[model samples]
Each structure stands twice: as C-alpha cells, then as structure tokens.
Target chain A: MGEWSNARATSEAAGIGAAGQVQVDDDLALVARVQAGEMAAFDVLTRKYRERIFSIIYNITSNREDAADLTQDAFVRAFTSLSRFKGQSSFFTWLYRIAVNTALSHLKKSRMRRFFSFETINEEMAPGEIVDTLSQKSAGDHSAQLAELQEKLNEALQKLSPKHRTVVVLFEIEGLGHQEIAEIMHTSEGTVRSRLHYAKQQLQADLQSYLS
Target chain B: MKKRRESRHEVSGGVTLEQLLRVKRAERPGPEFWADFDRGLQQKLFKTVVDRRRSGVRNFFRIVLHSRSTYAMPILAAIMVAFGIALNRGSGDGPLPQAVTAPVDMVVSVEANTRASSPGAERFVVDLLNSGGESGNFRKVMSLGSINTPDAGSTRYVADQLGSVTGRGGVLSMGDSF
Candidate 1:
C-alpha cells in the first residue's frame, strides 16, 4: 500500500473515522444492551469478533495457545470496561484497540521462550494464484510446499521487532487503513507508515531465498 | 482473476511484499478451534466475575477516583498541604533569636594609665567619661591589652557591646563604631 494513498484518504475524510454506518449502529445497540445488564449481548459481540481478534494476536505471538489466552483476556477487559465506552469511536475499533494493547503488553512483559507453530492456512485460499506460482518452483507436493512457505514467512515476520511486525500485520494482513492503525497504536499516521516501510524492507531481506 | 494487485514497490521477482504477505491472512484457525476456545472463555469469565467480586477495594477506589473525585480532590490537596507544612517545620527552618545577633554600638574603656600619658585637658575629658565605672549591662567585645599601655596599674581597659552609656559608664566614641 502507498503511504500517501492512506494519508490522502484520511485527510479527505478527516475527523474520527467511523467504520461503516450499519455496523457501527449495530455495535452501538449491542453495547447499550450489554450495559443494561445483558451478558448475552456481550457474548454476541465476542462471537462476532473473536476470530478476527484471534487472528491478529496469533500472527503477532506465532503461538496459537498464547494467542487464544490473550484473546480471552482482551474480551474480558473490554466487557469489564463497557461502562466507560462512551462510543467515542466505533465499538469495533475500541475492541481492536484493547486486543492490540493486550497483545503488545504481553509481548513486552514476558521474555517467553520463542515458539513457532505453523498452523494450516485457510483451505479456500490455499489454491490461490500466488501459492500456486511459488509451489510450482519448489520440488514438493502442495502440503510440503505450503509448510515450507509458511515457515519462511513466519520466520521473516518474527525477525521484525514487535512494533514493526504489528504494522505489517495490521496493514497488509488485516487490511486496516492508516488512520485506524494510528488510533489503535496511539501514534501518528506517519509513524505507522515509516514502521511499515522498515518492516517490509526487513522482511524482504529475511525472505531473500524464498523471494528469489 | 485477482491479478495480485500490484504495488508500486516490488522485489526482483514478480511478487510485491504486500501480495506476498497477504498469503498470511489465510492463516486463520478453523471453526473447530472455537468450540474449545468458547469453553475455556466461559470458565475464565466465571473466574473473572468471582475475582471482580473479591476485588472490592479496587472497584471501590476506582469508583472513588472516577465519580467522587470532586470530594476526593480537596481531601488529597489538604493532605499534601499538611505534609508540606510539617516538612517545613521539621528542622533548620525558623528565624534566629534577637539575642543571638551582634549589638549595634561598641564601647572602649579608657584606663588611668592612658590618662597619665595624656595632657591635663584631654585627661579631664577621659576621666569624666571613665568616672561612671562598670554600672551598665555591657558584653565584652575584646581586650585592649594588645595596645600595650605603659602602666596598667591594676586598671583594665576593654571594648564592650553596649547600646549607649547615655547617663552611666559612657562609651568612648571611636570613629562612631569600630
């Protein structure tokens, strides 16, 4: 993604970027229901976003178990903090902010033994054009080739520092725009772009063999 | 045909970094994982509710800090002010006493030996000044023994810090005050 493209879009539609009207409205209603002593509504919100949140944390941690644990903690924190949610931003944005912070905090606190468990990719996208092209070059079956690519990708991602990895994950993988990520990271849009640039350069260097 | 939307930046190979990294987006866990994830979440939620109940002090303080800050603010300010006052008065903080300070005027006693060396008119003036004797409250500033008078003859001369020998033992003026 071009840095100026995000900057121009954010500038054009400046002021507290609302995600989408219907989704924001639904989230607001659900949040109100949760505030009115309805635990089921919180369950609904949790169910709605748990997969996406888990994916974000999982990409950062490189461990499915740690990602699962941190995801639950993020939800619990959001539920407990529902009263203070004055709908300044969309509930979606707020929840993602909490999840990202929870993951970043866990990474900082624990000098954990690095564990990388390359889980299976989505079956639907496994036959995509990019994977197909790379698979043809490697001398192996589909499963073996996918595994090799995943290991290489994760290794390259892990080489980046946590902040830089977060930028790449949120921008490229999550498809989040600059303004939203800036808000989540509590930083300037320029900083996010810089981190993304640096992170991409580092990934390119690390995966030189695979890219070649 | 999603022609792998090209970015302006790319490697020597055809794959752009964004296009290459987008493959990671498919690393999402399948539906089966949520079965156990939901089960563990329910257990953790129950434990969190119990823990929140147990943390009465934390919630109470949080409420006090958020809602009742108007009242709490004054109390906090008062406590800080009291602490500052106590610290100021602890030690090495008050003014010195008046008696501990040096006096304004200084007096020099003229002995009989000095009078014998002087002429008669000067001797009369000196005698008149010394005649009052040691009647007033005077603090000794220094001894005039360093001057080495020809004959001391049982009379001692000294400088004292007396405000004024107005009607009694008059303080001989020495260039106002030494």
Candidate 2:
C-alpha cells in the first residue's frame, strides 16, 4: 500500500509539473498578445479560465447568480487592469487572485444576506464513486446514500467561516497546494495549513454520522 | 514516515476530503448556462470598457472642480491681475472710473436689483451707470476732487438736484461736497 501510494504521488507530482509548465507557456503567449493591444486575445484567456474561475467563486458564494455576476466582474477587472499585470506570476495566478479577492469582498459586503442553495451534481464520474469511497469503511446503498452525503457535505461546507471555507474550497476542491492557497489568501503557508486542518476537523465533526 | 503518516491521517475519515469536494466539482451549471454566460459576459465587458473611457473624461473634470484652488485659481488670478494692469496703463486721463472705485457690495446689490426690476428701467440704469460722464449725479461725484476749479458752481447745482431726489438725509451727506 505504501509503495503504491508513493508511486501514485510521484506520478501525480510529475503530471502537475508538466501541466503547469504548458499552462504557463500558453498563458504567457495570450497575455503578450493582450499587452500588444489585441483585445481578442483576452477573450481567449477568459474562455479558458472562466469555468474554473466561476467554480471557485460558486463554491464561496453558494449562489449561482452571485457567482455568475462576480465571475463577469473578475474578468472585467482583469481586462481593465491587464496593463498593470507584470508577468511576475502566471496569468492564471494573477487572475485567480483577482477572482478570490472579488469573492471575498462580495462575501464581506453581503454577510447578512448569506443563504445556501445547493446545486445538483451532473458531471460525469465513475458510477458510485462517492458511495464506494464512503462504503469502503462503512455501509450504505451506494446510490441513494451518495445523494444524502452530498447534501450533508454542502451543509457542512456552508457552516464553515468564509476564511476557512475559502482555503478548503481552493485546496481540496480546486486541488491547489498549501503554498498556492497561501499566495491566493495572502497569508503564510503555515496559516493555510492550520486553517485547512481546522476546517477538516470541523467537517469531520459535522459529517461524523455519515462517515461512521 | 512521519509525512506518510500525516497523509494517512488526513484521509482517516471514511471518505477523504478531496473525494467529498469532488462531489461539488460536479455541480456546475448546464451548457445552456455557459452559452448565455459567454454572450452576457461579452456585452458586459464592452459596456464596462466604454463606461471606463467615459468616466475617465468625467474624472478629469471632477478633479479640476475639486482642486480648483490648486490648478485653476492661480491661473484665473493671474489673468485678472494682468487685465487690471492693462486697464491701469490705459487710464491716464483721470482717476479710475467710479465703477472701479465704487464699493463692490453696492455694485453687486445694484446689479441684482437692476436684474430683478423692469427690463426698461434696468436698461436705462445700466446705461446711465456705464456712461458715467453724462449722468448728473455721477458727474457731481466725479468732480468732487476738482471742486475748487471752475466746476465748483456746477457741483453745487448738481448736489442740490441730488438732494431733492435722495431726500433730506442725502442733503446732509452732500453738505461735505459743497
């Protein structure tokens, strides 16, 4: 098990590195075109990252309408401030920072009006993936049980503080590293790790019934 | 070994946090939503860019209005001072015009009253004030400095007329002029 896990980790790290390199090259080319006064190049960058950016915002806001609006706002801000974007970071990183900051500000302003409404999951996944993962250590009818677990998961997520929720969403859902999350959150990696640990502990306590 | 143990501990729950989060990754809006999103975003971006350009012009004016003392006041004062110097250079014939020497508050009040009164009366008073030499009352006031000269008799005559028009109090004030 240890050997297999180590091998998987190695392969995943290599895959991420290669993917990141390709993304960096593509983003640089697109950003250069934008800097040279080609407005259409920005559309390409927006198209590429819009879904991911939207997903990040959606997880934070939990309201599709607010997410949609904020996603547009983030892209608009990025395009307007594109000239000030020195290539010190990858284009996505800069874009991600903007999107995160926009969402955080929105959350701050609309704190009183926060209400959670979970959306249905429709993406293609291996049949019973969530159920199988859960059932490996417990027991349930994989189909109906998975639905309940999903609802519980979203409830637990919404219960988290915005700061904790943001770190968890970015790290776990978006598969970002602690360092990357630290950069996005504008804090030390140690803070990011601490928040993630506390967030997971809270989730564990909230979903204790489902997990057991 | 510690790192491995930590990794294992992270996934100690029946389902890993990553797997639970994956459930959410699947919860995206449909294709139709994206179709609408792209079109809506395009329109919004175009409007935003255009609005930003418009606001840039507006912001320039706003800054000028707010910071008038800094950039605009000095320029305006300089122009006024230069115009005054030019007017002074040209006016060697006599003392400065009564319009220049008159108290500003009195002129402003007269101008306001003239505007508020009948148009015909406004036109006459404004013309009389502008053409100061011809008006009897104005000529008397202008010649006060030259009372000892040949205009002393004319000054006394005009003062009596002004006293009648302005009443008893006016006659007392005009006594100094005589």
Candidate 3:
C-alpha cells in the first residue's frame, strides 16, 4: 500500500482518462526492472497489477480479510518465484497464476472447516471487512436497477464451480483472451472455449430471474 | 470475424449475451480501479520481501553451520580448477596441461591382475590410449601418455592402435619419450 498511495496520487494528478491506459511497453519495462532487483520497479508492478489480482481473488473467495491475506501471500509467492518466471508469458499472466494458486491453497485449507464452502460466500460481502461500509451504504435500499443487477450477477458468480468461476472471471471479468486464459489455467485452448461456453450458460441460467 | 459478428446478439433481457461474453474481454478497468488495486498489492509485496529476507537469513546460517558436502563439492572443484589454472598461468604446472603434453611417455601402466578386473575394458583402454599415443590427441593436447603392460590385453590393443598412427591415427608408441 506504500507505493500504491503514490501511484494513486500520480494517476489522480494525470486525471482518470489517462489512468486506465497502462502502456504494455511500460509494464514490460517495469517488470524488467523488477527482474533486475529494483524495489521501485517491483512497487510499480505491484501497483499496476494488484487490483486485478485482488479482484479475481475477491470474486472467488468473497471475503475481504481472506482476500487481503491471500492477496499478500500471492504477491509473496510471486516475488520468491520471480527468478523462475520465464518471460514466455506476460507479467500479468504470471501474476495471475500466483494469485490463483494462493487462493486455491487457501480454499483447500479452509475446506476442512464446516462453513468453508467457497460457492456459499456472498460476492458483495467479499474483501470481507472492507465491504461493511459499502454494505451499510446500501442497507435499506435494494431497489436500484444497477444495484439489483450487481446483486444478481454476484450471486450467480458464487454458484459456479471453482474451475468454471475461474474461466468466467478470466474470460468475462478479467477479459483475457481464450488462449491466454488457457495458458493461465494450464489447459488447451479448446478446453478454455468449452468451459467458457458452459460457464456462460450456467451464469445465464442462474441470473434468469433478472433477465425478465 | 464472421462468426464473431454473427454471435453478437442481445439477449432476451436488457443486458445482451454479448455483454456477458465481453466481460473479461470488455474494456479494462478505469484508473481508479487500478489505483485501488495498487495499494493492496504493494502491502502484499512488502510483506513477501520481509518474509523472504527472514527465511534467507535463516537458510544462510544453516548452510554455513552444516557444511554439507553437496554444497561443498562443486565449490571445492571450482576452487581447485581456478587455482590449477592460476598456477599454470604463473609457473606452468597445471594438472590439465600436464595431462596433454605430446612429449610425455605414452605407456600407461596397468595392474597385470586380469581375473580381478572386467574383461574387454583393458582392450577398450588400450584402444583409447593407443589412439591417444599415436595421434597425440590425448598426449599432446591432453598431455597424457603411457599405457601399462600389466593389463596385457589393453596394452596390446594400445600397441595395435599405436601402429595405426597414419590412417587409423595413433601417435603415442610404447616407450616413447616424454
């Protein structure tokens, strides 16, 4: 969060329109610097990729505290394994792999607990503690159209299997290419396409109530 | 392209099927989103560095204390090689250089005990040594010479190899001068 504050301040100064546009070359440069053992370079990379990784974890785990902890663990593992990172894949792809692995390990550990079902967690209530404020803001009024859609979407996402949820998150939310998602998931592109197809069907069925 | 275009259709509800399909491929998150992500990611990175540093320090001392041979062998070999090279550079007495001298004696002595050792190995050694002796590949470049008579089969094979120095290529002959 240290350099994130600075990044945020810089982006804010740059204005919102320019903020979304992170140049791929710049990202690669920063990664090179990170590989060269520059902490500032790593900090920039963390700032750039943190939210996407966090969002993916949050989508699956849906608990703020767990998300935060898992996210930190993910970054830690990524840093330690950075030397082994072959540049065959992009930096984000590598980061995504680390995040997914960390989250899965967390889920595996929690699976022993009675109430530890990942699919049962509410998406809106994810990033667990941090959302309390947001939840309170929407406490009384569940009447808004966008809010209702968001709720429906979140609920439907929770109903997915971990594998399908991952496919959906990467393909739909994260918007990675099918090939890229295939690489991240360590599967064939055909499998990614099939899973994505099935996931979309399931999501559509789950949110059927909202469609009308 | 055609298939994708055909596939792009609005669903029965307000949000199209295309919208759902477009999610991950949809436009990237805004700057505010990234800014938020950065904060959380940095804390995670810092925590990891600290953890690794702690683990690294522990490992460094553990290695120093145990003095494991697995760790020691390569280091020892490297140092020896370096020292050998350095010694050769100054006084010209390196083991590798000495092994490859062309003028060195070609006869490599072998223990005559035949029943004790494996068969054909002597012949193979003889062939190798004889080839080296005559061609001087092993003797001149490798600085190794001499095949011993105790291993008669190998020695004879070496002798045969030494005889073939012209076409078959043997340079080191038995009793050759170093």
Candidate 4:
C-alpha cells in the first residue's frame, strides 16, 4: 500500500507540475489579451476554468441551478473587474476567490431556502476501478455500494457549515494546496488547516459506517 | 513530504477523504450543458452591462433627488434662468413682433396727448359746449370720438383684447374706438 501510494504521489506531482505551468502561462496570456480589450480571450479563460469553478460552487451550494447562476455571476464579475486584477496571484486563484465570495454571499442570503440534492456521477468521470477494488475488498455489489457511498458523502458534505465546507471542497475535492485555499478564502493558512481538520473529523464521523 | 504526511495523517478513517471526494468530482453537468454555459455567461455579461447603464442613470436621478436643498435650489434656479434666457433668445431670432413694451399708464398718457393735439380735439370741445354740460350728450359725444378712452381699471382689459386683435404687431391705432 505504501509503495502504491508513493508511486501515485510521484506521478501526480509530475503531472501537476507540467499541467500547472501550462495553465498559468495560458491564463496570463488570456488575461493580458482581455485587459487589452480582446473580449474573445475572456471566453477562452472562461472555457478553461468554468468546469472547475462550477464544480466548486456546486459542492458548496449543493444546488446545480444555484451553482450555474453563481458561476455565471462570478465570471461576469471577473470580466468587469479584470482591470483591477494586478496579476499578483494566478488567474485561477483570483477567479476562485470571486466564485467563493459569490457562493458565500448567496448562501448567506438564501439560508432559509438551503436545499441540497446529489447528482449522479457520470461513468466516464467516475473512478470505476478504484470503486471496484474497494468493493471487492469488502462484500457488496461494487456499483450499488459506490453509489450509496457517493450519496452519503454528499449528505455529509452538506451537513458542514459553509466555511468548513468551502475548505473541504477546495482542499480535498478541488485538490488545491492549503496556501491556495487560504488565499481563496482570504484567511490564514493556519485557519484553513484547522478548518480542514475539523471538517474531515465531522465527515469521518458522519461516514463512519460506509468507511468501515 | 512533510505536507503530504500531514495530509495523510489528517484522515481519520481507513478510507482517504481525497478518494471519497474524488468520487464526487465526476458529479458535473454534461458536455452539452457546458457548451451552453459560455453562451449563458455571455448573456449574463450583456445583462450586467445593460443593468449598470440603467443603474447609472437611475443613480444620477436619485442623487439629484436626494441632494441638499441649498445645492438643489440653486441648480433648479439656474436651470429656470437658463430656460428663460433660451426662450428670450429664441423669440428674438424669429420675425414675430415684440410684445407691448408700453405700460398701461404710459399708453393712456400718450393717447391723451395725441388726442389733444389732433383736429378731433376741436370737435370734442365744440360738442361739449353745445351739449350745455348735459351728462348724456357728453357721453354720446365721447363715444363718437375716434379715440378709445378706456378707464384706468379697464385699460388692461382693453389692451389685452386689442393686443389679441392686432396679433403679433400690437399697435393701438388712434382711429380705434371702444
């Protein structure tokens, strides 16, 4: 297990380094073009980051429609405020901050109407082999058990407060670093780490049955 | 390595939180939905621009409404003065005749002087002498006179009526009688 983990970690690090560099370069160029009044360049930026932004918003809000609206709102705000962007941070980080703030504001306003529904995972995007391996190691139909786990995970995620949930979504799901999450949340990295710790504890307690 | 170890140690149960969260990474809208997302964002951008323009206009009016009375009154007065000046200038550019510049008192005195100087004055004096100072004959002779001798109170009323009759060139001819 340790060997497998190390190998996976090395591979992921290599992939991330290459992909991260390319994405940063592309984002910088697109942002410059947008600053120069090339609106089509913004469209490229949107396409590149829309899925990630939407996913983060979706996880936080737990409502696809609200996520879609907030995602669009975030992009629109980003476009309008592009001039103020000094490029101190990567474009994605700035965009993430916008998305996070928008989602947080929406959550605050619509606290009464907070309803969460889990979406079914697409087969192509799902880690079928991992689920199969885990399921084989246990005693259950792999797909059915995996679906139940997915449902429980979503419920557990929704049970978290917006702040903690945001940290978890950014750190665990989006695979962002603690520093990046801190920057997005506009909090200290220590606060982010603490939130992540508390959130994982709560989620672990909630999903104890499935995990076992 | 330390960060990775810390992350790994943070997981409470046997299952990693990262793996569990990864399962949900697939929970997204379909490709067709994403294709439509850009179009929707574009529409939202367009709507934002339009709303900003509308709000800008609304805010301008709002500021005008909420401004201090001291500032607002002066601005309003300036606007009214400007409007008056514009109207005055516009009237000057047209070929229309000027309004009656003569005051009613001045007009009456001028008419009296003209009547006294004309040949009609001699006839008026002869008629008055032949009437033996009778009030009815004096009124009849006064009515026969070619000049309108409106009383001080009726002067404005007569002038207004005459001004309308004469149209733009409001000249009171001496031969007019009332």
Task: Compute the DockQ of candidate 4.
Answer: 0.15
How do all the candidates rank in terms of TM-score, highest first?
2, 1, 4, 3
TM-score of each candidate structure, all chains considered together: 0.61, 0.61, 0.51, 0.61
lDDT by residue (A1-212, candidate 3, tens digit) is 23333333323322423432445457677766556554455555665676778767866675655775677677777766766776776677778888887777776778655132222323332322223323443443322323344445666776877788887776655656667677778898899899989988988787554332
Q: Candidate 2 or 3, higher DockQ?
A: 2
Q: Which sequence of candidate numbers ranks them by lDDT, best first?
A: 4, 2, 1, 3
Clashes of 2: 0
Going through the candidates in order, the fraction of native interface contacts each one reproduces equals 0.35, 0.36, 0.16, 0.43
Candidate that beats the other on lDDT, 1 or 2, i.e. the better one: 2
DockQ of each: 0.12, 0.13, 0.07, 0.15
The 10-residue segment with the lowest total lDDT in model 2 chain B: B169-178
All candidates: TM-score of chain A: 0.88, 0.84, 0.71, 0.86
DockQ of 3: 0.07
Candidate 2 per-residue lDDT over residues B40-74, each given as its tens digit: 67656556655665786689656666784775766
Clashing pairs in 1: none
Model 1 is docked with a DockQ of: 0.12
Those runs of model 3 whose alpha carbons end farther than 4 Å from true positions after fitting are A1-24, A112-143, B1-13, B17-47, B68-178
- Local accuracy of candidate 4 as per-residue lDDT tens digits, A1-212: 23223323322322445546676778899888777655557767887778889988999999888898899999999977888899898788899999999999999999988777666677566665455555456554555655666777888988999999999988767777777778788999899999999999999888665453
> Which candidate, 2 or 3, would have the higher lDDT against the true structure?
2
